[model samples]
Target: MSGKLARLQQQHDSLQQEHKALQQTKNQLNQELQSIQRTASNAIRISNERNDLRKQVADLTRNVADLRQQNRDLSNESNRDWFLIGAAVVIAGILIGLLLPHLRFQRRRNNWGAL
Candidate 1:
């Protein structure tokens, strides 16, 4: 009877040791899972920030393109204005050159009649 009791006690001690080891393993696995959750959260935040920055960059690029087009349009308008002014000045110079000789001949005739 004593031998039977000793064997039962040994079996109970082994079962207890296995249960303790399983509990330790469960605790380690829980800690690892929590660490993974934190890492996933950080990754999600970084991805969202990257997406927002990309949107901002796209908007800025569009704005720059629009401004460049406006600048080109303004430059074309200025060039057209200068061309018109130059053409008008040339026409006025030609009219004055043609008219001045006729006026000088008329003045010479009027002076000879007075003499």
Candidate 2:
């Protein structure tokens, strides 16, 4: 009877030690799970931020393209205006050159006839 009781006592102590070890392992696993959750949250936030930045970059690129197109259009319009102005000046100069000499000759002829 004494031997059986001692054996049972030893078995009980062993079980107690195993239960304590399991509890420690459970606590450690919980801490690790919390850490993993935090890491996952951070990763998600970073991914969202990266996506936002990409979108902003795309919008900016589109804006730059639009601005470039506008600049080209303005430059073309300016060139066309300058060409029209130059053509007008040239036509006016040519008309003046052709008429001035003819008027002067007519005046001279009229004066001679009167004399």
Candidate 3:
């Protein structure tokens, strides 16, 4: 009877140890589940932010294109204005060259009393 009691006690201890190991495994699995949940939440937030950044980049690209077109238009207008001014200056220079020599000859003749 004593031997039987000893065997029964050993079986009880073994069962208790097994139960404790199972409880520990359950706790570890719970912790892993919580970690996975947090990671999923973070991934969703990051995805939203990435979409927002993409929209911002698209808007900025369109703005840049508009500015580039405006710059080209302004450049063309400036070139046209410069061309007109250059032409006026060349015409005035030619007129002065043709008129100044005649005026100088007349002034010299008047001073010498030859005409």
User: Which candidate should be chosen as best, given TM-score against the real structure?
Assistant: 2
Q: What is the TM-score (0 to 1) of candidate 3? A: 0.64
Least well predicted 10-residue stretch by lDDT in candidate 1: 104-113
Put down candidate 3 lDDT per residue, 25-47, tens digits, no spaces. 99999999999999999999999
Error of model 2, residue 22, in angstroms: 1.1
lDDT of candidate model 2 versus the reference = 0.96
* Over 4 Å off, model 2: 105-115
Task: List ranges where model 1 is wrong by over 4 Å.
Answer: 105-115
lDDT of 1 by residue, 1-115 (tens): 9999999999999999999999999999999999999999999999999999999999999999999999999999999999999999999999999998888553445566676
Clashing pairs in model 2, backbone N/Cα/C closer than 3 A: none
lDDT of model 1 at position 83: 100
Give lDDT for model 3: 0.96
